[model samples]
Target: MSAKVSAGKQVFAIVKKDVLAELRTKEMVIAMFLFVVLAMVVFSQAFGVILNDLDRVGGGLLWVAFLFMSMLGLNRSFVHEKDEGCLEGLLMSPIDRPLIFFGKMLGNLLFLSIVELFAVPIFFVLFRLEMGASMAGIFLATIFLSNIGIACVGTLLSTISINTKTRDLMLPILFMPVIIPLLIAAVSATGGIMSGEELTEVYGSMRFIAVYDIIFLLVAYALYDYVISE
Candidate 1:
């Protein structure tokens, strides 16, 4: 019990340190937010007629923005640690490797969610997208579910890429192929919500996302120690 408690505290400490660092530097989060907003604005201007059928296409556009934004954020997730020489120290610390993975993964998740919250309203405004409040809960739930898989898979792969010579280039290559399944489910769920499709299909997509997140979480838990040590 005490061991579990200590591990929990370490994870929270990792998260808190990341939050404080982001507040100070304001680099990663700011860049992600800007990328998302600008992408949408540009699309709206250049593809106005195409965007008219938002209900059908908006979900794809939203995922494209988020997928890239996630890549930007995930690419930077470990920059501070790697550049400041903290990665070595973090690995050497007494905290369990699993804890470090969770800590970093949770931090990534939080930052991504924050950017999404701000970006989505702007997306709604620019695109004139709407859904009944009855559907709002499902809409938000779908996004949050997808975020889990994004954070989970992104963080695990990031640990590998951060140590590479071509870290930036390596991440997308590793991330893209692995992330396709999750992206499909996410787009399906959100597109269903936007199109006011039946609830059952949305629920099915959400379930698949939930399973994907769980599988990745377990994979990360099992492999992080080995991955981070190398």
Candidate 2:
């Protein structure tokens, strides 16, 4: 019980530290927001004639924007820690290494969630799409499940990429292939909701996402200590 409490506090502290630092900089969030919105605006103009018909393909476009925006944010998630030597400091601290992984993962998850929370509605509005409240709940669930897989795989891979000279290039190389399965499921589920496809099929896609998140979360948890040490 005591160990659990300590782990919780350590994780919270790391998350708090990252959040406070981000609030001061306001850099990652703003950049991600701009990128997502800019993608939408560009798509809107380019596909103006088909804006009304976008709902059929809206899920694909939405995930494309989010996937890229998330990569942008993930690329920076560790820059401050690595630059300031905060990662080394944490490594030497009493906190467990797996806790460090959880801390970073949660921070990524929080940032991704915050940006998407606002962006999703704006996305719907921008493309003149409407979703019933019932379907909306499932839509959000699909995105959140996919976000978990992203944060899990992304946090783990980003840590590895940060130490490389070609980190900016390296992250995409390492991250994109691993995340493709989740992306497909997310797009399928979200598109189903928007296109009013069968609920059973959408639920199956969400289940696949949930399984993907769990699998990677375990992989990251088991590997983080070794990953961080080098």
Against the true structure, whose TM-score is highest?
1
The whole-model C-alpha lDDT of candidate 2 against the native structure comes to 0.92
Query: Across residues 57-105, which tens digit of lDDT does each residue of candidate 1 receive?
Result: 8998999899899999998989988998998998887888999999999
Model 2: ten consecutive residues of lowest lDDT: 1-10
Candidate 2 lDDT, 1-230, residue by residue in tens: 34444889899998999899899999999999999999999888887877677767899889999999999999999988899798899898888899999999999999999999999999988787888898899899889989999999999999999999998789999999999999999999998899999899999999999999999999998999999996
Candidate 2: give the clashing pairs.
none
The C-alpha stretches of model 2 lying farther than 4 A from their native spots are 1-5, 48-50
Clash number by candidate, in order = 0, 0
Residue 119, model 2, lDDT: 97
